[model samples]
Each structure stands twice: as C-alpha cells, then as structure tokens.
Target: MKLKLISSIFILLGYNSFAQNAKTDLSDSLVKDKQVILAKYVPMANGEYLYKGYQIPIDSFINRVNDFRADFNAQIAKDKLSDLSILKEKDVMFYSYNVLAHYQIYYGMDSVGMENFGKVVQEKRGEPNFYKLIDSAQKKAFPKRLSNDERKRLDDIIRKSTDLNDAALFKTSAAYRTWLNDYLKGVQRKKYLADTALGYGGDNVAMLKVIAAEISDPFIKEYLLYTFTGTVIKSVKNAGAKESAYKDFMAGTTNETYKKGIMEIYINYKNMSSNAVSPDFNYTDINGKLVSLKSLRGKYVYIDVWATWCGPCKAEIPFLTKIENDYHDKNIHFVSLSVDRMADKAKWISYVNDNKLQGIQLMADKDFSSDFVKKYNINSIPRFILIDPTGKIVSGDAKRPSDPALRKQFDSLLK
Candidate 1:
C-alpha cells in the first residue's frame, strides 16, 4: 500500500507540471500570433501601407484587414477562449482584444470598438476593491498589510492594466491619424462619421479631465493624460491653455515614463516658439533652380508646407493665390514648399503645373527628412510659417491662408 501511494504522488506531480507548461506554451503562441497580425497591418515607417508586399489602396487594405479579423474572431469563439481563466492571462487576452479593437476603430466601427474596450475595463470592475487597490498603491507606499493572495492579485491587475493602457492608447492614436488621412484625401464615408465628429474641440482640456475622472483603470487615465497633453502641446494654438494642460497632467501622474514623454513634448513645443531662428533648407524649385531660406533673407517669407495629395491643402490654393497677388510688390516672398514623398515627385510636378500653383514652387529633395521639416516639427500639412526678413520666425505656427486672421496679421506686418 505504501509503495502504491508513492507512485501515485509522483504521477500527480508530473501531471500538474505538464498542465502548467501547457498553459505557458499556449499563452506564448497566442502572443506571437497577435504580434504577427499587428505587424502585417501597421503602416510602413514612411506612413505608406503595404499588403502582402504590394502597395494597395487604403480601402482595399482595410478590406483585407476585415477578412483577417473575421478569421481571428472565429478561431477565438471556436476555442471558447472567452473563459475567465484564459481571459485573465495578460498576454493572451489583452493582445487578442487589442488586435480587434484597432481594426474596428480604424475601419469606422467606433461603437463596437468602444464596446470591446469597455468589456476589458468591466472585467476588473467586478472586484469591489479594484479602485481602492490601485489608488492606494499609487498614492501611498506598497501595501504590506495585504495577504499573499491579495498581493498577487494586485500585481496581476497592474500588469493587465499596463497592457490594456498601451494597446488602447496606440490604437486610438492610429485611428485618429487614419481619420486625418481620410479627411485630407477628401474621402468622406458615412461609416467614419463618428470619428469625424470626434475632434479636439474647444475646451478639450476640461473635457478630458472629466472623462479621465470616470476611467476605472488609473493607469489608463495617466497614459491618456500623456497622449492628450502631447496633442495639445503640438496642435493647440493657445499657448496659455496648452501650458496649463501640460502642467495639470504633469502634476497628476507619478508615472516616470509618462512624465518624461510630457516633458519631451513641452521641449519640442518650446523649440518652435515665436522669434526662434527658423531652420533653413535648400531645395529645387519647379524650374529646376535651387532656393534656400538664406537666399530669400531680405524679404519676409510666408512658407506654405503642403502636399499634393492633401485636399485641404489644395482648398487653400485660391486664397493663397489671392494673398500672393495682394502682396506681390510687398517685401515678402510667398514660398509654397511641397513635402510630397520623393516617390510622388512626378505627381507633385504635374499638379503644380496643371493647377498653375503660384509663388515659389519648390520640392524638398528628402521630403519629410528635410532639415526644415524635422526642426519645425511639421507633422501635418498646410502648415504656414511667417519668417521675418532677418530669418527669425514671426510665427512658426502661422494662421491658415483662408483665416481672416492671416490677412489681418499680414496687413499689420506690411504696415
């Protein structure tokens, strides 16, 4: 009887070990599969997308992404992967949901994407101590009073929150960028109307704070602060409000990584402040002649950095033409600098010639890598800059040509 009991004990131990190994193996496999799918859909470093080694239209690529999503969803359902035990695994659940969330948001299924995001948050919301646990940890020293199981649970929650925060932040940012691309291309679809309506509206800082207050995941709130503050710093024209927004976020979060990111955004904003010496560039004009900021130093330079593919940039052409005509004899040079990719240079040349685009039509040799673009932090198109005759920036983020404020500012400058 003793010999038989010893053999059964060893067998039970081996079975438990095998079960643990299987769980780990499956988690790793799921994570790898998720990453491969994400990598396949992510845009190239240059912002151009490729599908299966070929450059296809955005619409076609989105369709391919939907097909992949269908297959992934079917697999998950067939495997009954929504069981709480498996779903609690950070790598398996968060990554799988992230893949689905990104495509849904990017392809105009806003409600469905948000529903999935809420489900992830709702999972932890069931624990009555969830908010208290995170708040205590963030505000005070680690809780040594909790039992081992409680401590382990807290650690698990934090790890899962981190994964969910990162994935949501990245997916939302990409979706916003995708919306901007669609808007610039003039592709208005009924499906993306929800995204269209969502913008950094007036008083976004206050709006974000209210939304942050309701967020169940404290880490998600902190990460969101970082994202919102960066956008405000870069895009918000009101210096006072943007500065206040940055300070508010910096004060609220203890996350060192997020703090560093916000600081970098502030530094970049300050680098492009008014009256700073503007970054110079040399590029070939449509006439094949070279032009440089230094060469145009004796006159005020109204530089319009634009791309041929941008519909909004093209919309301002008529107004820009009027301004060029109005200020033709003034001590100012209207420079329309094209940031179209070098691969699209021929198309840019054709557009400029066909449209009779006025002013000094120049194309950057290195496109976005041109020194001026990097230095000025030019991420969006139709960016207008006003540099004084001495090459110091009058307004690094100048008013758009269509804005009455631009003509008003010009009138003052000319006088």
Candidate 2:
C-alpha cells in the first residue's frame, strides 16, 4: 500500500512539471512573435539599437515607443496633471509635455483652469519649459523671425485680457492682422534688397513687377515705387543716357513716377508670364508609353502637382480618382504629376498601381525643379490647376475634388 502511494505521488509530480514547461514554451513563443511585429513596423537601427541609440530588444523598445506616443497624444487631448502623470516615469516626458501644452494653447483649451492660457504660455517661455520647445520648433520650421514689435503687440493684448475667452478672441483677431501686415512689409523689403543686389533686371525685374501688381499695402507701394525709380536711375547711368534725362524723370512728382513704375512693372510681368509657359514634358506612363503635356492641349486639363511621400497628396488621390471616373465621358483630362525623384520611380509606379490611380500618372524626373512646377509657381502641394479648352488658365486655385461644392461645379461645367 505504501509503495503504491509513493508511485502515485511521483506520477502527479511528473504531470505538473510537464504542464509548467508547456506554459513556459507558450510564453516564449508569444514574446518572439511580438518582437517580430515590432521589428516590422518600427524603425530599428542595426536591429539592436533603440531610443536615442540605446541597445534594447525589439519587443521592449517598441513597447516604450508605443507608450511614449500614447502618453504624448493623451496629454495633448487631455491637458491636465493627471493625464501628464501617465508619462511621469518617462525621461522624454518633458519634451512631450511641452508639445502637448503648445497644442492646448493653440486650440484655446489650455484655459480650462487658467483664465489666460495664452498669456501663461507666453510668460512661461524659456528652455526646459513648454513654450520654449514650441518656439524652438517654430523657428526651425519658418524662415521669418518673430519681430520685437509683434511680440510687444501680443504682450499688450495679453495684458489687457482678464480671462481666457477675451484673450483668445483678441489673439485670433490681432494675430491674423499682424501676420498680414508683417508679410506685406517683408515682401517689400525682400524685393528692394533683391533689386539692389541683383540689379533691377533678369528674374528680379520680373518678380518685382509681379509684386507691384499683387501688393495692396500703401507703405509697400511707396517703397516699391522709390526702389524702381532708383533702379531706373542706375539703368540710365549704365546705358550712358544723358544725366539731364535721368534728372527729368527723377524730378517728376512721386505720384507720376509711381504710376509709371507700376505700369512698367505690369508690362514686364506680362512679358514674363508669356515666356513662362510650361515646357513640353516627356514621362513614361504605366504602360511604358511616353506622354507629353503639349499633346493634351486640345482637351480641358487638370494638373495635380504632388509627391508620393506627401500625405495630403496621397489623401486627395482617391477623391481625384472619383472625379476622373465621374467625368470619364467629358472632354476633361486629369493628370497626376509626381515630383518624386527619378530614383523613386519604381516606388511611385508601385504606389500608383497599388492605389489604382484612375488619372494619368507621370513622374517629374528632375523632381521639384521640373519645368511644369516652375511654370505653375507651385510652392506647396497637392496643388490643382485647371486649363480650359482654349489653353488659358481656367482656375489657378481649383479646389480639391473632395470638396462637394467643387465637385458640383465640375459637374455643371461638364454639362
């Protein structure tokens, strides 16, 4: 009876050991799978290095990454100490908090408790704080500096406001107006400096002429007139024209000189426009057939200037495809011109195929410097330009096809 009992106990122990080993094996397999998933999605350096060059396992590194991103997004959405506490253990929490604070301030949600969040944000400026991080990012992104005058203006508005709502309203109004005024002033200054340095000829002359017509500010108008007059005087000297003629032109009333300068600028701009037509472009289509813009002149054309890497451009493609399908019977032609470099041609083509772009897909081998981009003055994308049947520009600022109103307009035009 004792021997039988001992044998039964040994059997039970063996069973328990097997179960434990099985559980351990399952856990190890799950961990390996998770690591593979992380390696596939997250950017891994040397398959070993992790955040900021720290060497860690792919699974562990990705967990931290996901945790950091989630905490940062949460703080932005929920601007409170409790939400921030989620990232308390993170070393990079300060940077994430700063971003969250700026986002809150921008959306006017930072005033949940503080009456004037914008003022607080401004006053709280300095490195290691939230506002400074935002400011640093802005400086890196934009070419223009925040002028002292503009800062003073913002400060005055903040000082006047006793509550968040008042401060937000004041900022919304004053900030927009100040931006417009400063933009006009900056453009005028740039034109004058460019003219002085590069001479009032070539591209500078063309650009100055365009600016003269487009600008509406009185101070900018006066500055442009004076600069043009100075240029004309220099031109006369270079041409060896009589000094008397130069004096005669200079002696005229500022108003008359301004009018003449404006006219001259307009004429020059017109000439430049005439000479700036998009050059004949040749790019292989999906089927490896060469296509050119000059060949598609008879039909109304819609050009989509975009790059594969541009998220906005990618988002608009589905809408563009829908528009193309809806207007297939019409004489309108849709073209997607990609500014992705030639090296990325295969990838571009793959994306077009994968997304099934209905419109004609063409690559700009020279990328951003492509002649069509320069002709259209495309500073940002996804830009849409419509050319009428007669070849004149129908609308330089055509809306994205996702806009229902724009789609309606296109349908009417087709009819």
Candidate 3:
C-alpha cells in the first residue's frame, strides 16, 4: 500500500510541472498581442525625438494605434476595465485619459472620447520627463535662456499656439522648441534644407522633388512641396531652372493629384511669361458692352483677378483705385476680372457700382477653372497680371497695387 501511494504522488507532481511549463509558454505569446490591443495612445515615443536625418516605422505604429482603439471601444461597450486597476497606471487607462484630454483641447470634445489626461500627465513640468534630446539648432536659438523649473512645459505651450509672434518668446527661452509647432517653423526649416540640398536653388521643381523624397510624413511633404512651388514660380520672366525642376519631378512621382497641380502651375508660368502671349478673355460689361482682350491690344493690361468674398481682394481695392487714378492718362488699361460665382452675380454688380471701382470692370465668364484663370492656374487671388501693349505676358505675379514697386513698374512700362 505504501509503495502504491508513493508512486501515485510522483505521477501527480509530474503532471503539475507540465501544466506550469505550458502556462509560462502561453503567457509569453499572449503578452505582446494583448499589449498591442489594449494599450492606448501608442505611448508617444519613450524618450526619443525624430526630426531631420531620421525616419519612424509609421505603418506599424499606426497599426498598434488602430488595434488599441478597437479593443478600447470593445471594452467600453462591455462597461468593464477587465483586469485594470486604479492603484497602478495601465497603458489602456493612460492612453484613454490622454486622448480624452486631447479631444477636449483640440476637438472641443469635452463630453466625448477618453479624458484621462488629467492623471497620466501628473508629472510636473521640468521633472525627468520623457521628451528627449534637443537638436543643435534649438540649443543655439535659445542662447541667453534662463533656467526653468520646467523648460519642456514652456516648449509645449509655445509649440501648440498658433501665433508666430507668441512663438518668438519660446524661440529665445525654450529648449526643443523647433519641433513644437510646425506651422510656424515648417517654412524656415524647408528653406534651410533646400538651400543646403540644392544650393539656393531656383530649380523649385527639383527642390520640390528633393523635399518630397526626403520627408516621410505625407502632409508635411505635400505642404512643403506646394508652398515652395508658389515662391519659386512667382517670377515667370525666366524659366531655365524651373524647366529642369519640373522635368525631374515629373519623372519621379506617380501621384496623379500632385502631377496635375504641378503641371497646371508650370503651364501658368509658361502662360504668364514675358516671352509668351497672355491668355485672352471676352466678357460683357455692366453697360451691356462686350469688351475683349484683343480690342484693347494697343494698351497695357494690368488685370486684377478678384471675388466678392475675398478679404485680401477687398483690402487691395483702395490701393488699386489710387493706381487707376494716378495712371488714368497713361497708355495702360486696368482691367478687373471678378471671379464671383454666378450665384453672386448681382452682388458683384452691386459691389462694383457701390465702390465706383475704376477702369474696365467686367465679369469673368467662369470661375477659377475658366480658360483665362486656368491659363495662369490662378488657384489664389488678389492676383495681378501685367501684359505689354502687344498682349504678351510681362509678369504672371505683378506687384500689388499698394506696393511702391507697382508704381515704379507702371512708370517703367509706360516709358
């Protein structure tokens, strides 16, 4: 009987050991998969920052975020934290709270999402925080900076604000402020990068290609490319460098929208060249008279493309009127083309008459996509175009009427 009992004890112990080993193996597999699902906010980089000369695994990071959201919503529906404890910060709890707070501030979602930001962000500013390594440029920008209890807090505040003037203070005081608010710093960063990459390049299309290729974030890449295109193409009098830039970009990308946008802008530059003839338009005036571009061929045309809803267009009006009055007797004609929609045709007529807008006032046959507007790809307005007496485009982007340069340009052209 004793021998039988001892043998049975050994068998039971063996079985228990096997079960324990299996449980350990199972746990190893479950941990990572569970963490990916339950975690919130993707835990904003542990203690590292990425800017220039670096890239992140954006696809994987986004996948983790999506997984977390799915699991979070499921848990919310069940009305249970499951294994969560308030005594310790769980990844799900931390993320949910922060996302809630983020929504409150940015999305006006005080009553929505998860607002646990109040708890996780309890670490006071200037504490041993996770936001990592300051760049060399940021360090130099704040040379005479005062020591702060929390420099990171100041950096965070300045980066989130919309005002550039408000940002000036942070530039001189905070560390790691360069990456804070990109809307303010983005243009400057790209210009510096472009200067380094292309050697103060007028080959904007080439510069754009370089910027697009270098940037990983889709939004920023698109924005930098688009913004620089305008600056580089504003002067259409010369197109040697631009032609090369355009060619390079065309060969590289398959993005249809980008291709279309760049192509239109390029065509606009060509259309507005001093060497190329201006795109003509014929429209009916308020007096029921048809005025055509060819009819005014002997005189220079300073065309103002505007609309009723455009605040910038309105601001230029007083200055434009002054130009009209000053140059009334010159061998020039100031033509105002209103791109106001058909719905606002009456409003356009009323505004023109009420303001007593000078020179030739004619309504555009169509809005921005009109044959005339598309010729110069006039995506934005208060646009001023200058044409020589022979109807050849002298400038696609002429000086604004308010500019003293406009008066100088007029005097030069009239002579």
Candidate 4:
C-alpha cells in the first residue's frame, strides 16, 4: 500500500511540474511571435531603424518597441480590441500609421511611390490594403458607429504626407489646421491622453524644435520657438523672470540663424544650473526607513530619478554602481529614487536588492506627482541631478558617465 501511494504522489508531482513548464513556454512563445511580427513589418537596416531623422540602432529600438507591439497584439489576439477597452483598436491603427510615417520620413519614399501613397490614402477615402486589418478590428470593436469627427481625424491623418517641406503637397493642409485643433480639443475631453497624442511629447517635440530652428519663416520660427520654450522651460512660479531673460536672448536674433542660436542658448542654460539647488525630497529606504534629502546637504549629492520598469534606468545601474564605489570616500552621497507607483514598492525593493546597488535606494511613493519631480520639471527618466556643497545651482547638464568628458569632470570634482 505504501509503495502504491509513493508512485501516485510522484505522478501528481510530475504532472504539476509539466503544467508549470508549459505555462512558461506559452508565455515565451507569445513574446517571440510578437517580435517576429514587428520584425517583419518594421524592417531594420543593419538592425537599426531611423525615425524622425534620428538613427535608432536596431537592438535599442527593438527593445523599446517590442513591449508596445506585444501588448497591442495580445489585446487583439484576445479579441478585446473594443472602443471601450483600454487598448483600443484605434490606438493600434494610429501607432502603426505613425511608425510608417517615421519610416517614410527617415527612408524618404521615391517620388512616384510618395505620390501614389498620398493619392491612395487621400483621394480614395477608403481603407488602404495595409490598414485593412486595423479597420476591420475597429469596426468590430466600436459598438456605435465612429463619430464624424473621429472619422475625419483618422482620414486626415491617413492622408497626411511624410514630407515636411512640401507645403503645397503635405497632408495637414491649411484647412486641416482647424481640424487638428478640434481633434486635440476632443482628445483633452477624454480622461487623459497618452503623451504621444498630437506629438505632445516624444520625438515630435524634438523634431518640431529642430524644424523651427532651421525654418526660414520668421513668424513660423518664432511660433515654434515660443512653443518649445513655453513647454520645455517655462515655469509659472518664475515666469516673468524667465520670460525677461528669454526676450533679451531673442532681441537680436533673426530667422536665418535664430534656431541654431537658440538651441545653443538652451544647451548653455541647461549646463549653467546643472549642479544647482538641491531639491528637497522624502522617501522610504529599502529598509523601510524614511530618508530626507536635507540630511545629505553637506556632501555632494547625486540624485537619480528612475523607475523599476524603465529599461534605460536599469541599464545605467552598473555604471552608477562603479561611480558609487569610486566616490565612496569623497564626501559624496548617491541616492536613487524610484518613481514607481506605491503599489510597486515590493518590486522596487526587489530590483534594488537584485542589482546589488551600493547607492542608497529609495522609493518615490508619490510617483510622478512627487513634489520634487514637479519642481525639477522632470518629463523623462534616467535623469541625473547633482547638488553642490552650498546648495546653490551650479551645473545642471552633467554628462552621463559613459561620456569621457563627464568622467573627467567627475574625477576632478571628486578631487
């Protein structure tokens, strides 16, 4: 009887182990499938895809894009691509369309191909073959018919050309400007839109700034400059002061050289305050002890704003660890604050421990809404903020450790 019981127990254990392995295999298969699909659609030259005039190496771009495509495909595979769903089918369509736009912008479609692509997207006013799958998904997903406004927005975007300089032949016609504004307004009506909507953030901001700086039209250039300055560095608390400085900077600037000059000015401004006023913050350390930035005021403070899920942030850990080791006795303090949601505390702590980071690790319980982040105007991650001994603003544009000059600066500063 004992022997029979032992054999039965072994059988059950084997079945359980097999089931777990199968589950893991299935998950990996889905991930691999998504990668294959993206690779097929977005072919890279030497494993790099250039977008918006930026050359993104294949490995880096693929790493970032794969997550987005996988989440999108997962929703589609699960038949959840409805209008009310968080991952709406329209979003996928827009993403694909935007990717194609970037691809065209970087690669430059042949004259004939460009003309034909524009004609089919615009004059036809029907679903193009490439977007048929997305269209079908949208129709099934949306219970009510698409609003006229929504349809018009999609049509306009589809008809838009990748060529930015061809004013007469471009997709966002003079008339479409009004439509674009209305579309942005409608998006605001939604609870919250992603940063990519209407190119509010992401590469669009950089692209527009570059164009504004290079364009010969004084009025257009000024407008773009205003938009860039307003969005990038304008703070309500210091508005009048910043504006006065900006006006003085722009007084003698002409359209011909204004863009390049302003870019230089901005870079200088960023560098000027690179190691400035230490921002005050409170966070819980890995041991669940509350730590305050004020306590570290006497020493050189290296504050890194990052998150557990941020890939770039994870990649920088090794370099950061090395810096911490080198500067351990230089009266310098290193602190890494994670901006992950409060619910992710466990994951944040686990990541810090797993990475064996020597620097002080803390969790930004308030996440992006943290007062320090708002004060710093932190829109992106892997940001390094250095605070000098006296707590006054010094240099704000400290280069990454990877840069030779930055390493030299660090070595000098430590000395």
For all predicted structures, in order, the TM-scores are 0.54, 0.39, 0.49, 0.44
TM-score result, candidate 1:
0.54
Local accuracy by lDDT, each model: 0.57, 0.48, 0.53, 0.49
Candidate 4 local lDDT, 56-116, one digit each (tens): 4333443445455566757666665343333233334334445433332233223343334
lDDT for each residue of candidate 1 in 1-415, tens digit (9 for 90 to 100): 2232222222322211111000011112332344455445554334332222222333454455555555556555566556432332333434433433333223321233333333333333325685554343222221112344643543343233422233333333333222222222222222122122334323344445543643455744555566656666666667776788888888988987778767866876786784677778889999889999999998899999888766456657778998899989999999999988899989998999998988999998877667777566565667898999999988878998878899899899888
The predicted structure with the larger TM-score, 1 or 2, is 1
Candidate 2, pairs of clashing residues: 115-164
**Candidate order, TM-score descending:** 1, 3, 4, 2
Residue 353 lDDT in candidate 4 = 85
True lDDT of residue 221, candidate 4: 43
Local lDDT at 308 for model 1: 75
Report RMSD for candidate 3: 23.1
TM-score of 2: 0.39
**Cα shift from native, residue 30, model 1 (Å):** 7.9
Number of backbone-clashing residue pairs for each candidate, in the order shown:
0, 1, 4, 13
